[model samples]
Target chain A: MLERLSDKWVTLVLTGLASGPRRYSDLSRRIAGVSQKMLTQTLRGLERDGLVRRTVTPSVPVRVDYELTPLGESLMPLVAAIKGWAEANIQTVEAARKTYDAA
Target chain B: MLERLSDKWVTLVLTGLASGPRRYSDLSRRIAGVSQKMLTQTLRGLERDGLVRRTVTPSVPVRVDYELTPLGESLMPLVAAIKGWAEANIQTVEAARKTYDAA
Candidate 1:
């Protein structure tokens, strides 16, 4: 389970879904650099883990949307926290890397 | 940075060092499934990221210890929360997977 949660794609997909439900294309576009195959797999993994819900609507194009389950919603804060930490500390980490590389 | 933080080995290593400083062997023993190469790589990555500190004591056979740096310590609560969520929700996730697979 930790392995699943620790996946980079999982983190990105969850973040994409955090605001609300999104169609497959929306996610693919929002999470730039994610391949279609990787995105699909990540969504499937999250769905299987009960952290995401896939909803299909009967429409002309047959719309498909992905959103967080309550279980998934519960995990958002932690995910957000992790993201926040990354954004806040990225410079520090980069500096450390440069120093380590030089040493 | 998010990619690094989302690594399974990173999660395990951080958890292993949550208590205090530990020798390389201690981390190896504690994180049961990690290989020597992976542990060494993970520790090196953590050190490079400025999340861990490695100290060597030149005594009988020389002693080395790895501990969380202040930056790493700052990230611990979030990591702990993630681990806690995994522990608390494993059953539900397992059930979800079972249901998903059956369908």
Candidate 2:
């Protein structure tokens, strides 16, 4: 569990999926620059862990959607909190870097 | 920054320092079971990122302390928020797992 939360790609994938279920391509697009291989691996991990629900729909073409299981959605606030914190404190962190560098 | 937050040890180390400055051993103890190597590496990374401040005090014996930089402390609410979210929703996550497993 800690290992899952600790990985960089996992959090990004989980948070991306938390927005709503998305297709493999949609997630690739939304996450910006994550390779297909990484996304596939990450989604597989989430699915295996039961945090993600992958559903495939039959249509003229095949459609697959990835949604947060209740477990996955449960993590949204934590992800948001981390994101919110970054939004709020990135400047502070940047300034500290400036100061530390100057010293 | 995203990479930093998404890393488990980094978040734990940040939150651990968020409470107050601590010695390496203190953090090792407080965090339950962090390896010395991992703790040292994580602290070094945080300091390199300027989110952590490491101070060495010379006494009959030397003492070293680590505390959040203002940047690191600023991250506390978010870390707390994550912990808070986890505490509130781990049960939901757990239940979802049971249901998913049963399916």
Candidate 3:
């Protein structure tokens, strides 16, 4: 369960969608290092979890966009908090690691 | 990195220590299904990351206790929110999974 949250791409993808809906190509472009396959899988998982809403608009070319649902939006602050904590403590953590390794 | 946050045991161990300090054995017991090796590794990682404080008491039989640091405590709310979100949406995710799988 928590494993899904840990997926390397999930956070980035969710954070990307937090701003607004993005087309598949746009999301793929925005999140660096995310491969097409992984993005698809991550989006599928989020969609399956009901955290992301997917819309397909038929046209000369089908336009598909991904956006966060309220459930997914609810996760934003938690995600942000976690990110903030990590950023704030990363230096300390690195120092501790060095000390621990030396000892 | 976010990967550490997603660690299967980190959340459980951090949550376990949030209330107060506990001996190694106590933590091992409190979080069911955590193997000795994994618990030890998790604690070492948390300790290295400066999230957990390890105290070794010199005695005929030395006792070691683990507790959360301020940094670790800061993570509690974020961790709790993640746990809460997962719990609240598990059923919906399951339902979505079924729908997704069927289509």
In candidate 1, position B72 carries an lDDT of 93
- Give the 10-residue window scoring lowest on summed lDDT in candidate 1 chain B: B1-10
Please say which candidate is ahead in TM-score: 2 or 3.
3
Per-prediction DockQ scores? 0.64, 0.36, 0.71
- Give model 1's TM-score versus the native structure: 0.82
**By TM-score, is 1 or 3 better?**
3
Give the per-residue lDDT of model 3 (tens digit) for A58-93.
986999999999878987887777777777878988
Clashing pairs in 2: none
- CAPRI tier of model 2: acceptable
Per prediction, fnat is: 0.79, 0.35, 0.85
Task: Give RMSD (Å) of candidate 1 vs. truth.
Answer: 2.7
Docking class of 1: medium
- Per-residue lDDT tens digits for candidate 1, residues A51-99, read 9999999999899999999999998888778778888998999999999
Pitting candidate 1 against candidate 3, the one with the higher DockQ is: 3
Worst 10 residues of 1 chain A by lDDT: A1-10
**Top-down TM-score ranking:** 3, 1, 2
